[model samples]
Target: MAKTKNPTLYLTELDVTRLEGIASRAGTAELDEMLDALLERAAIVTPDQIPKDVITMNSRVICALEGDAEPREWTLAYPDDADLAAGKLSVLSPIGQALLGARAGKTVDYRLPNGTAQRVTIVEIVFQPEASGQFTL
Candidate 1:
C-alpha cells in the first residue's frame, strides 16, 4: 500500500501552545507524533510558497461549500463558552483541520474514520478575518 501524504501546517503560537497543553494533559506521545506528521505534510502541500488562499492561524472566516446553499462561518480558535452556543467548531476537528488555510476553489480530501475519503470544494470565502483589516498578529 502507498503511504498517505500529510500537509505542512502553519500554526500560530497560541495553537502551538494549545497543542502542547493537549499533549501534556493526555500524557501520551500522540501529540508529538501528530506535530511531526503535520510538519511533514505541510512541507508536501507547501513545497514552495504558501498560496494566498491558505488561512493563517487564528483566522475567522466564512467558508462555503460548492454545493451547499449557505456558507459556514468558523474560526480557528477553540470557542469559548459563548462561542460554543453559536455553532463554532474547534480547528482540531477533522473537518476544521481539512479546511484550515485552504483557498477557495480548492478541492480538499479528508479521510474519514472508516477509511473513506470525504471530498469537499471551497466554493466561496464570504469573509476572512485575516484577509480583512483586523488584528495583524
Candidate 2:
C-alpha cells in the first residue's frame, strides 16, 4: 500500500487513548492496519476542542457514498456499541475509520480490505456528543 496524504483527522484525547488500547490488542492484520492508520492521521485534542461539525464517537452523521446520490446515516461508535441494524457503525469498520474526525463538507478516501478505494463525503453531523455537552461519551 502506498502512503498517501490523508485528510487531517482530529480526535479527542479520550478517544485516542481508548483507540490506542484497542489497536494494541487487535488480532487481525486488517484491523491492525486500519487502527494504525487512524492513529497515525489523528490530531489529538481535548474533548472541548473537538469541532462541533466533526464526526466523533457517538456522533450521528449523514454521508454519501462516492458516486451515489442517496445519503446514508450512521452513528460512529465503539465496537461494543455497534449494531448495523440500528445504524450504529463500529470504529473497526473501514468506513468508520475513514469517517472518524471527518467534518461536515469534507470528503475522505479509504481502501477496502480487497484494495478497492472508496470515497465518502460527510454531509452533516446530525448529533455530535461534544456538541450536546456529552463529552464523556
Candidate 3:
C-alpha cells in the first residue's frame, strides 16, 4: 500500500462473506494481503442496508482516470466473471480492489504493472446491484 490515506469502505455482508472465502481459498500472498486490508477496513452491512452511493459487487461505475479525457465504464466482478471485452472487472484486480467499496466522487489509487501509481475518480455509478434490489444469496 502507498502512503496515501485509505478512504472508508462499506461492503455488503454477502460480498464480505464471499470475498473472505476467496481470500482464504486463493492462498496467494498478494491477494491475501490486499483482501485482508480491505476487509479489515470495511464496514460490513446487510444487502438492503448498504448505501446506494457505495460501490458493491457487480456495480457498474464510470471512472475518470487522471489526465485521461475519456472516462471508462466497468462492472466489478469476481475473477471468473472478469471479461475485459465486456467491461467486467475482477475484484481481485488492482483497479478493481480500489473500486470496490469506494463511494461516488472518491479517488482511488492503484499501482500499474510497472509499479507506477495511477488514480481514478469514481465519477458516477451507473448501477449497483444492492441499489437495484438485486441481492445474490
Q: Highest TM-score, which number?
A: 3
TM-score of each: 0.59, 0.86, 0.90
Q: What would the TM-score be for candidate 1 when compared with the true structure?
A: 0.59
Candidate 2 Cα outliers beyond 4 Å, as residue runs: 1-7, 27-32
Overall lDDT per candidate, in order of appearance: 0.54, 0.84, 0.87
Point out the higher-scoring one by lDDT: 1 or 3. Answer: 3
Collision count for each candidate, in order? 7, 0, 0
**Tens-digit lDDT string for candidate 2 (4-57):** 255377888888778877777766786677767776777777888887888998
RMSD of 2: 4.3
Can you write out model 1's per-residue Cα lDDT over 1-137, one digit (the tens) per residue? 11235544443333445656765676767656755555445432321233446665455556565457786776555423215446565555566667665666677777766887676666665555445544333
lDDT of 2 at 38: 74
Tens digit per residue, CA lDDT, model 3, 9-79? 88887898899788888888987788879977777778888889999989999999999999999999998
Candidate 1: C-alpha RMSD after superposition:
6.1
Please give the distance, in angstroms, between residue 96's alpha carbon in candidate 1 and its true position after superposition: 1.4
